[model samples]
Target chain A: MLDQAQPMDEHLGFEALYCAHSDAIYRFCLRLCGNPTLAEDLTQEVFVGALQGFHRLKNRSSAKTWLYRVALYRVRAHRSRHESRNVSLEGAAEPRSVSADAQYAMRLDLSQALATLSPAQREAFLLVKCQGLTCSEAASVLRIPVGTVKFRVHRAVNSLQSVLSDTPEASHEM
Target chain B: MRCSSVQRRLSTWANESHRPQEEHRVQVHLDSCEACRQYQSKVTRLDYLASEFKPVTLERDLLPNIERDGVRKGSGYVPRVFFARHWVAIGAAAVMILGATMSTRRGGAYSASAQEAVRGMESTELDRTAYHQSLWQAAGPHQEGQLELLDQVWYEAGKWREKSIPSFGGDRIFEFDKSSGLVRLSRDWRGKIISQEETSPRPKQIDLQEFCKQAGIEGAEANAEDLGTRTLNGVSVREISIPTYNLQRTLVWLIPGTNLPVRMERQNEQHGSWTTSWLFTIEYAKSWPPSIFDSSTLESTTGGPTARASQPFHDAESGTTNESRLSQRSKLPNRNQPAFRTGNIVFAAYLSTTKPGPIDSACASERVAAQLRRPLDSLASEYGTLQSYGSDSHDTDKDRAAGSKDQVYNLRFGNHPVRSVMSFTLGSDGVWKATSLKVASSATP
Candidate 1:
């Protein structure tokens, strides 16, 4: 039994942290891996790493941001490990669009457009656009310069526009 | 401003956070230049479209998954140095054993003494038994710390009751009624019952016989060895050692007369070091009253049934209380609704107009549906369907909040056959809203 006054109970604190941010982390992994099952596995693995390194976590304020950073690294490592087996990130399964509603269809079109962006751009775009992180924050998560994040987001937007324009509905809407 | 300057700042301008001077310059350029204006509009549209992509929800609650995989405190740690040298042999043997165990139905071998001991323990009947136990784990070199005490447990075959008195505060009682298939947990804070919850336990049977056999103890090919007799806690016991394919050494201390386990210890050899993984000591008792297992006794001993105020009353007709039943019914999707099948995934939506009664209201007097109608007829709507791989009936928890039921739903989309999930919860207004929706590629077929 651990002392209640201890700054943190390793298992319980990690469980609390997981409960608070697992959904966001799952969404991040889902977008990055393009496979829900793989994303789930990656999410579990990320937390396992978080548990092992919990004692070393210096600043608790940036736990969410720190988790994202860890997730990004794990995703990269997974891709690299699978790359030798001919498992391409883009080749991962795509989500099927069930609703024929124009809005739903357009969302699906945007998902496809997102897939066409470079991996770096996609990461930046997801952090800034999907995850609502600022450029500077995204840079910190990705361990890149703020300028690189901006450039990636800019390129991602441009590529998405170009790809979406190829479809008649998106072109007409624009 | 030059068209070149405006072109460079186009992204910044579209993001709507440009400096006032830059914004004015970009606006002037856009107003005057058709090409830049088209470019600016396209960027804005792209941003809008991207923002419209809903955040995906996980098909299942990940907390349980995390808890399942989460490392427990004081679990033995195996250094990487040890793993590097012996991991290959261990991994090969583990894979072979796991394959054999899963693929075949044949029982494994057990020593005659081990079998007799297990049979004796299983055959021994008791009206009720009470015992106290203290659990300990190794912290570091030269340190073994007390983890917890099983304070007390009243056991009667399928039904078992246990209470935990934490070091800091509060006492928790866990009662499992196997026949009823319900596990009730009540927590007492400073002698006041603070919280109580009832939930159905997962339908998994603990097969001790199968477990012993799988540990390479029972089968003809088993490598179980008798390490002679030893006295544990003043009781003379026979010691048996079983080495498993996973590099785990299991030491069982069995009483020859009763064939009951007095103490068991498991150690794992990894990376050239042996670490104690688990240790359990059992003390048996002959009898206790059947009434000891009742919740009423717990309440009387602790206090009055004050905690019952927080829980919904159980309904006799339906297993669930009326409050939970209405909540469940209010959330169920329309069965007549068409399911959307895209790729290997199928989706469905359920919308309801029912208003739930007040939380603590009696089942008979409360209107099942609300009297105050919403502007929209339907208060809630949910989209998603659970399609398990091979299970005939969809296994779902009735007491779970509307959208977050725990079940394995097939979520394969596009060419990738990954599992996906989507669920919703009902707000106070009786409107169903998706709590989570997620799709992931399956690692296994």
Candidate 2:
């Protein structure tokens, strides 16, 4: 939130990167991994990995992007390590399908829809809509063309809308 | 409006197109058009509803705490730099001497401006040969010892190998800590549950296979195919991929650090792999207590499903006699080539010009009805495969291996979508095999 990437060389500077972005990263990871504990551990891991490979960081100014890249990359690697775990490409719940916890229901359906989209599409949508990255920034993080990133986001959004529309409540919500 | 034009406008307005001038026209047109207006409303609703998918924001204070804990404990990357100035070296007499050097980003370690540090750094002399020699061998004293330490850790961990065995297709599992010279093998059954997730299928059908069985997968059919070699996280490994076998292709990365495949993957056909990259080194727990290996993975496949059958059985491929020759070649050294043959037979059954004649001809054991006909009464379904009007033997009967020597029994499919799916055959060993199973007609690309 506050130019979170600390000065690369200073002892205090390194601490600031963690202070600034760790929680945001942890939260992002929790949503991605669908587990709070794992998200927390992964947040630790992402930073640890960043530390291990910190010397490779040629430009410190792009530290925020770099951190996000590391977090997302670790998430990807974790997904791959447990690669066979099946996360179906189908809607999990509808808006009406979630009544007890309205906030949770919405999140569940959003997650459900996001899970259905390809990984690239999900990353694009999250980076642009949720994390508030510009298409270019998201593209840089993803190392894809801006046009591809835009396409992925649009496709993800359209599919998510369709997945949500499947529920009678999402239909009404729609 | 043309359907295409309407679709474009609908897409643009749904995206909240960024042009101010066009916004007026779109809004005016949408206001008049109920269908378009309904679509926009639907889209707006979706947007409000989309936030549910986002992660919960962390408490503002969590970062500082984590940062504080992480910095001291974290590992750092240092770089390769030398203090000798080329100009200074050339100008100096026979004696070599240097004063000091300062810069940012050196020796795989991140450091701020060297001049700004609290104390001026001392340049320590490094012996090049000795440093290289130490890498092949471990850096510390305990490096050259037996894995007694890790064995003790595995014994105490309790879950040494119970959890992870099910995930793999029964390949050797080993982990090496370069820092510590310990190689933990799964005593014919050992591994840690590195990760596990419950499968949530939307339609809630029974899973693809009953109870993720460690069914007797004879051996890894993985061999050199579309191969790629590169050093991944300092582990020199070879990565190979096969496009078919299932909707998702399989990738096996064989780590040179250990002769085993350290990583495995099943990538979706469409997006390839979302997480194939960014795989770095696997960090072990700082220390494993002595109680790790007390638990057991011995009966994992023994009782549940494959207990009795997992023991090597003669399939159409297994090197046993009861099975036919065609099935045996399907298990050739060129792993995919043989499977490619069996898959061809499977495809042929799907695309036979003659139906009902022989879904499986080799099962006949001996010469039976040479002229088997398709059951025309049964409407051709996707399962029966689109049968045509002739047999494969009817096409030419000439083969390079046979030279018209042996007769091939093939039911041909006519009026087919692709000319490629027509031809099928057995190998030089008289095993039923096909060139490739191309189901491009299914629109799966």
Candidate 3:
């Protein structure tokens, strides 16, 4: 929601939108997309989309929900097409090849345990813990039940405890 | 198990994702409990550092594509009403229904009187081609003469003074010969009218067995017991209401004293309860032409079911049916008239939007009712459905319902009502063809 988002009277009124929500939105996209290069591209596209249909908006308060809905749709589309894990995540996994080996080293020192999580768990964890959203709101964003959100976060936390507690389940399973 | 349940609670406490009331509850819990506190703090660093690891940004270039998509969708022009004319377009298939004689007060506006039941009229538009195709394969092989009938009757509902006329809309497919009396009904007749929004109250007439298969319900019988007889809507009739079924299985005022049914009410049951929400009445009926019940019109296998109970408990409502009268057909007559003459009638139609068309005013005049049937029946015959309900709205002299629409003469023998004219046609053999029928303005009766 923005005071500047007044029913796009000007054709390129979205230029203001790009400056307004772009940073926080880019941060959201960065986490969701898991790659800086792709995230930058997705963040711009999301704003462009919001601008194109800005005339139909009756209320400015709805912009948050609308922007989030659009951002997720793009995230889902990107996920579908890129079946292979092509981009380097900051700390999740050691990608097959990368130009940013120094960046990868710094990422590795952060927390290698997060790399062990399932994609669903990682998404739930990131939306809840990193973004400071409640489990229910994160569940809403992820389109999952609150219970499943709790369960995945629980398992992630348990595994994280194990990774640091020196009694990891991976040791038993392997 | 102790740890497992608490682990769920721990998951609840550790849930940093959902930022709603649960998070508030989890935050309060963590402040009190030592085990959860250590657990949450461990969860904090693990997830916090992990989230930033894959921090990526949205690609900006894709915005053009999304914008292009929105513009393309908005600019692409399509007339909203264009697809409505096509029968299969999911919007146009409607039977021209009208008439529920209100007991009007001194000023000619509708008012609810003690006698409020729609009756005997059977009107429905059937796409007869589907039945012919499906039956050809199901029946294996048939002689050129074998005929299958999927008779549908749509009752015309009357209007009231409140602009609150209870419209009876739903389709019933009673395929002539099915072993279990497997009648497929959507929007049960004999229920009180419920909704305020307008939708296609009638669903497409899918095959009965296929309908059951889709709904995941057994078609043979309804799960109901007899609640016994009671007087409903002034008709001393059997009242049968089924509550524990997938769909509304009740049949209210099902048995007709006159040839036409007094009224049929469908009560929908959801979540172990029923709401008396829909109504259909058939107030007018005379014997259909002799040809309607002829053996040649029989569609099902001879040994197919009659009124017998084929599955578990059949609805007690249908118990009164006379199986001996189970003739595969109940066809409307197809009369032989070759040329347009003095008695030849033509039916014409106008859409509800067609600039205050002829049929709009026709509702007020009985003379228009007579003149319109010829072309309307022609439309019906094009789809291979024969017409019933005699030229005089009241086919039989023994009638209880009183509406002037019943008294109008269909000189050309067209029986279907002209609501939205689905099509127009001319018959090859004679004047009865829908195309051949013509409409000329007549002196107001």
Candidate 3's residue-wise lDDT over B12-55, tens digit each? 44332233354346545654676765654454335435434423
**Whole-model Cα lDDT of every candidate shown, in order:** 0.41, 0.35, 0.33
The digit string of per-residue lDDT tens for model 2 on B341-445 reads 111111011110111111221211111111121221121222222222212221122343453222222222222322112234555665433432322233211
Model 3 compared with the native: what TM-score?
0.29
**Whole-structure CA lDDT of model 1:** 0.41
lDDT of 1 by residue, A93-135 (tens): 4322233353334544676667766678888888776664657
TM-score of chain A of each: 0.74, 0.71, 0.59
DockQ of each: 0.10, 0.08, 0.11
- lDDT leaderboard ranking: 1, 2, 3
DockQ of 1: 0.10
Which regions of candidate 3 fall more than 4 Å away from where they truly are? A1-20, A55-62, A84-113, A164-174, B1-34, B47-445
Candidate 1 residue B157 Cα shift, in angstroms, is: 42
